[model samples]
Each structure stands twice: as structure tokens, then as C-alpha cells.
Target: MEPLNYLASFIQSAETGSFSAAARRLGLTPAAVSKNVARLEASLGLRLFQRSTRSLTLTSGGERFLHQVGGAFSTVQEAIAGVAKDDGQPAGVLKVGMALAFGREHLLPLLDDFLLRYPGVLPDWHFDNHPVDLVGGGFDAAIGGGIVLSPGVIARELLRTDLLVVASPEYMKGRAMPDHPTELARFDGIVRRSASTGRAKVWTLRHDDGDEGQALLRPRVIFDDPEAMAYAAMRGIGVALLPMPHAARWLKSGALLRLLPRWRGEAGTVSIYYPSKKMLPAKTRAFVDHVVEHFRRPEVAAVFDSGRYR
Candidate 1:
């Protein structure tokens, strides 16, 4: 292998902290990766790692070397990718992270057309309701709301993810519809507990006139998933706070009814997150453009908009 290959092995092993894991990323055997690092050390006459039976830790020299060269190495890789992608064909595995329900209901429908357009690209998607480390986890892209923005990552907005309070017609059959956010206190509540914080979410509803009120929902049922909350609301469990994307379908089909149509909660947004635009891989670029274009359509945009639900 070339010296660059040895350096790449060292960097991957250092970042992941295990040769086996680095091997998976590099498409090499663990033994081969370890050997490449060893060769690189011999050539430089530097002990780069403190090796033991179960762990590998970088030495002072290794830390300094990595700090000096890591960014340049990444740039070199990106340049190579750019050159390959310049042919205007998007190919290879496109790894992405997304919430389960949103991926299935909204984005999955677009996959057939995307694949038909770019047959060379294969998608490897991970569905989780929580935020993921896009660069650290090696995801080409991720889709969701409230994903924290970090250096070297960018997002393209897809929809306004406004939170809506909704309940089934059956649940509200005998009860008078709430004319104000305060009246929501009278109904049962299907609340969402934050998975990361383990506390029930407190919703604050806002109106266009700059008035805001705390939605005082009595917690009769609780879930960690927004989709589950929507389903519970449809089954007459209780009035639930849900992001417009999750509740849109039900609201349109009359499975759920919106309450206090003038009020809504600001749930940041739903965006497609990806790496910096500079030298972006063809597949990643294509996928991002495709999704953004799809959402820009008037019919699709109206469906996910909170104002349309009113």
C-alpha cells in the first residue's frame, strides 16, 4: 500500500478507536489495517499508538500528527470524490438517518422516482426518532426536526414543522370544542415524554397576534414517539400535541380534528441535513436536491403546512 493508504488507516483507526471498526469503514481486514499502521510507524520511526490487548490509544506524537494532517487528509478525499462525481453520474451507497414514521410516510414515496432516475445509487437508510451524529456516524444525510447544527454540516429546509393540538371526533363528541388554549385543560391529554430528558413535554401555543398560552393538558397517556401520539389521538385516547408532518394525514382524512385552529406551537423545522456543499458526493447532492424539489411543489407543501390544517 502507498504511504497515503497507511495514513488513511491510521486516521480511521484513531477516530474510531478500534482497528475492526476502521476496517469496516475502509473495506479492509482488521489485521490489514493494523499492519498498515505498523508500517507507517516504522517508516516514520514514531510510536503512534499505545497498543494493548483490548484497546488502542494515540501517543503524543500520533495526536500531534493527526491534528496537523487530519483536515488536509479529509480535503484530499473530498477532492477525489469530486473528481469521480464530476462525470455527472451519481452512484454508490447513500447512507442516511431519519425518523421512522417521517421516512416511511413522506420521503419513502419519492424513492421510486429517485431510483428510477439514478439506478446506480443504492440507499442504506437508518430510521431512528432521535438526532444522530451526521459526520461521526458516517451518514451522508439525515432528515428530521431540531437536529443541532455543527461545523461542516448544513441543512435545507423541507417544511415548517408547526405543532398542533388535535383529538378524535369521537373523543370530542360530547365535549364542547375548545375555543381557547385554556379550555384544553378540561380534556384528557396524550402527551409526549422527551426521550433524551425523560420529562413530559410542556407545550406553549402561539397565535399570529403575538399571544401565547401554555397548553395545560392533563397527562392521561404518554408516549415518546410523535406518530404514536397521533395514533392515540385518532383512537380517542386524548388530545395530543403533534408536529404537523405527523398529524397532516390524519387531519386531512378526518381521523383527527384540529383544536383552536388559530393557535400553534413552534417546533423548529423539518430539514434535510448533509455535509458542507464543497465537494459533496454526487449521490448526496442528488438526493438533497431531489427532496428539496419535491417539497417545493405546491400540493405537497400545502399538506404539511399548519395553516392549511385550519
Candidate 2:
């Protein structure tokens, strides 16, 4: 096999953490996969992986090689697709990283539609609340909210999400609703630990009267998961600050009610981020355009109407 093929086999083995799995994926035998990796490691004069009877793990050198070589592989794939007459059809594995809550509520439902439109494409999605290193993890793209800090990554804004102060009607049945940000301190706040920042999200409210205040809420119950936080808020546990869409269904059902509506904070933009390369694969570009166009629909925008609060 060629050097590039050996490198590709090595990457596949590292990603799947098993020679057998890589072999199945690449249509090679387990022995062939092991031999290719071993030869590649010898050519580079380094141990790329630490293997045992039960598992395999990448060495530091292996990790670095995967990151650098993955980009090179992506470039080669793009070049081949560009020159090929069948460039109109995108076919390849496209890995994506995104927030768990957002992906579940938004992206998951649209996945079937995407696959139907691009039947030749295969998608591998990794959903987590924490920030992901796309290039290191070999992700083709990531959907994220808030500020993106990675260098050499390009970001395109998709939509804006507004923060809402909401509580279950049962929680507010006897207690008075907070009319301003200052009053929020008296309420039992349900806080969600942010996966990206690794801290509890601080609630910031700006009133229509030109008054702005921020509060570092200590939750009566702290949930690392957004879905759990939404559930707790629905059960009348306490006031929760969340994106509008997460609380929308409950709000419409009268299970949760918005508080201090005029004091809601500024909108945060959701965006798709990827490597800042001159040429992106047609599959990735198509996915980005699909997501952007979906969000631009009037019905979708109404679900998380950032302008409603402002």
C-alpha cells in the first residue's frame, strides 16, 4: 500500500481505538490494518500507539500526527472532488460536533431530511455541552453558541438566541414574580453549569428603563445538563435563565411563565465554525448552507424570537 493509504489506516485505527473496527471500516483484515500501522510507525521512527490485549491508545506523537495528517487528508479529498466530473454529488464521512441540547432539539430532527437530500453522504455527530477542539478531534464542523476562541477556525452566524427569565406557574402561584434584576436574588434560581466555560451561567438582565444588573446565581439545584434544568424549571423548582427555545414549549403550555420580560438580556448568536481553509468539501459547504437556510425560515425564527423580548 502507499504511504498515504498507510497513514489513512493509522488514523482510522486511532479514531476507532481498534484495529478490527478500522479493518471493517476500510474493508481490510485486522492483520492488514495492524501491519500498515506498524510499517507507518517504523517509517516515522516512532511508536504511534500503545497497544494492549484489550485496547489501544494513541501516544502523544500519534495524536499530533493525526491532527496534522487529517487536515492534509481533507485537502486531498477536496482536490479530488473538485477535479472529478461527479463533484455535484457529495460522498464521504462528515463528522460534526455540537451542543447536546441544541443538537437534540434542532439538528437531530433535520438529520433525516439532510440525508435524504444527500443520499451518498454519511454523518457522524458528536453532541456535548463542552467546547470541542474540531481540528484535534478530526471534526469537519461544529455548531456552537457564544464566543468561539479557537484560532484558524472560521465562524458564520446562524441565528440569535435570547435569554429568558422563566419560572413554573406553580412556583409563582403564591410567590410574587420578580419585576427587576435586583429582585431575582430573592428567588431560588435553578442554574445550569456551562459546559464551555465550566462554570455556572450568571444571569444578566437589562431593563427597558435603561437599567442593567447581573447576578451570580447559586442554584437550589444545579444541573450540568440543559434538559434537566428545563425539567426542573418546569416542575416549579425555581427561576431559570435559559435560551428561549428551550423554554418555549412550556411557556406556550402555561406550565412556565416568563418573569421580568422587559429585563431580559442581550441576544447571543449561534454559529457554525470550521477550519479557515481556502477550499471546504462540497459536503461541508452544503451542510452549512442547509443549517443556515433552515434557521432563516419564518416559523423556525418564531420559535426563538430574540426580537420579541427586545
Compare the candidates by TM-score and give the number of the best one: 1
lDDT of 1 by residue, 165-213 (tens): 9999999998999877878889999999987789998989998788999
| Model 2 root mean square deviation, Cα atoms | 6.0
Model 2 lDDT on a 0 to 1 scale: 0.79
- TM-scores for all candidates: the values are 0.84, 0.72
Candidate 2 error regions (>4 Å): 1-77, 84-87, 146-149, 194-199, 216-218, 306-310
**lDDT of all predictions, in order shown?**
0.88, 0.79
Q: Give each prediction's root-mean-square deviation over alpha carbons.
A: 3.3, 6.0
The pairs that clash in candidate 2 are none
On residues 167-240, what C-alpha lDDT tens digit does candidate 2 reach at each position?
88788888976666777888888987766677777867777778888854547987887667789988878888
The regions of model 1 sitting more than 4 angstroms off are 10-24, 28-35, 45-88, 148-151, 276-279
Alpha carbon deviation, residue 170, candidate 1 (Å): 1.7
